[model samples]
Target: MRVTILGSGTNLHPRRAAAGYLVKTDNLFLMDFGPRTLSNLLKTSADRHQIQYLLFTHYHADHFSDFITFFFDAVCHSKFVSPRADLRIIGPKGTKALFGTILRTFPSFNDSEFRVTLKEVSTRSFSIGSTRVTPVPVTHTDRQTCLGYRITFQGRTLAYSGDATYAPNLIRLCRDVDLAILDCSFPKNRPGEAHMHAGECGRVAQEAGVKRLVLSHFYPIADRFDVKKHAAQVFRGKIIRARDCMTLSV
Candidate 1:
């Protein structure tokens, strides 16, 4: 399995793009489509036409604002070509309503070239081609739907924690994963309420026994602190600071 961190920064940062990841197994899987996702996707060594599934963690602008742009770019506007296969969008509860609102707001957007199927899922296991996916509810902003995903394919496992606070559900979802990408949005010295600090992310990865932990989704303050050192104190595994266009093989 191959995983690419297309965008690793938060909405506040100017250098790194927002949350977006590309996973390749039997089929192409994209996790989280944040604001700069479209441009970041073009930078990776991935074929955009091969993307078949999009797993959304929530509807936050920093996490899902590129959905419209992605769809627009996928369609061939000037030339006539065969339509592409349908793309499946799997998200937390209220996903359908969220897209419905977008469609209504953008009346000029057309879906004739390709079809999009949106499905809301939670705490359940499902399949996309040859890969298995499990969505685990996580602690986040109040009244907002957030989730962490566990993916297994060809005997390899990977987990992604998207915009989550420290919680048991996240630990369970990432237990024993070959690679665990977590949200370390704040410095350990200055903790945030809705997102995990470096220390908290380290503790969770340690408790989950992940082989490798990738700290990501950093705000600007994270650049001023030693995020890797903070996480390394608690997690005795390979710690990687996520960067845009970084790739990992499992």
Candidate 2:
């Protein structure tokens, strides 16, 4: 599978966009849809209608605001945009309610024209076609279950830590995965409480024994320092600094 980094930075970063990723298997899977990511998503190699699943980590505005536009274009405006398939919105426990609320707020969206299914996942393994998905709980907030997803397809495993602190669960989620897309919101010295710093990303990758590590969700301050170098201090594996529109075959 090929995974595209639609948006690699945090919300409101001057040069980078918030969280958004596209994993293309037999079908398309969107990891997160943050502000300014819709345009990037449209620029991908695949068309919009091919997207069959939307996997979200949490409901942070930076991570979810673009869904409104995505829904409108997919369901209402582009109703005749080729032969569209049913879209599944997957997230934490409150996934269904969030979409229901959006439907309520925007009565104009043609919900009947297209079938949008909401599936709320927990810290358990589930399946979509032949793909295996595991939503692992991470430390981020108390209001909800902050998830980092581990998706296995055709024997290849990829994990994404939406927005999380350095914790044991995160290590488990990324353990032995081919790639670990983690939150490196801040540089090592400049740590973030709610997110992992670049050093922590390396430490986690090293402990988890991941083959490769992608330090993403960067803040502007992180750009001032060498993030890759910082992460390399602990992790000896292949470390990639995520950039917009960068695609990797995993």
- lDDT, candidate 1, residue 237? 97
Query: What do the candidate models score in CA lDDT, each in turn?
Result: 0.88, 0.88
**Tens digit of per-residue lDDT, candidate 2, span 1-250:** 7899989887899888799999976668899999888888878777877788999999998898998888877765445645467888999988878888887778666454667788888787988778888999899977867789998989999999999998899999999999999999999999867888899999999999999999999999999999999999999999999999999988
lDDT of 1 at 248: 95
Candidate 1, 1-250: lDDT as tens digits: 9999888997657999899999999999899989887788998778787787999999888888888887766665312555567778889999988877775576444544667788999888999878999999988989897999999999999999999999888899889999999999999998878999999999999999999999999999988899999999999999999999899997
- Model 2: residues with Cα > 4 Å off, grouped in runs: 77-83, 110-112
Best model number under lDDT = 2
Deviation of model 1 at 107, angstroms: 3.8
Give the runs in model 1 whose Cα sits over 4 Å from its true position.
Answer: 77-82
Error of 1 at 122 (Å): 0.6
Candidate 1, run of 10 with poorest lDDT: 74-83
Give the distance in Å from residue 159's predicted Cα in candidate 2 to where it truly belongs. Answer: 0.5
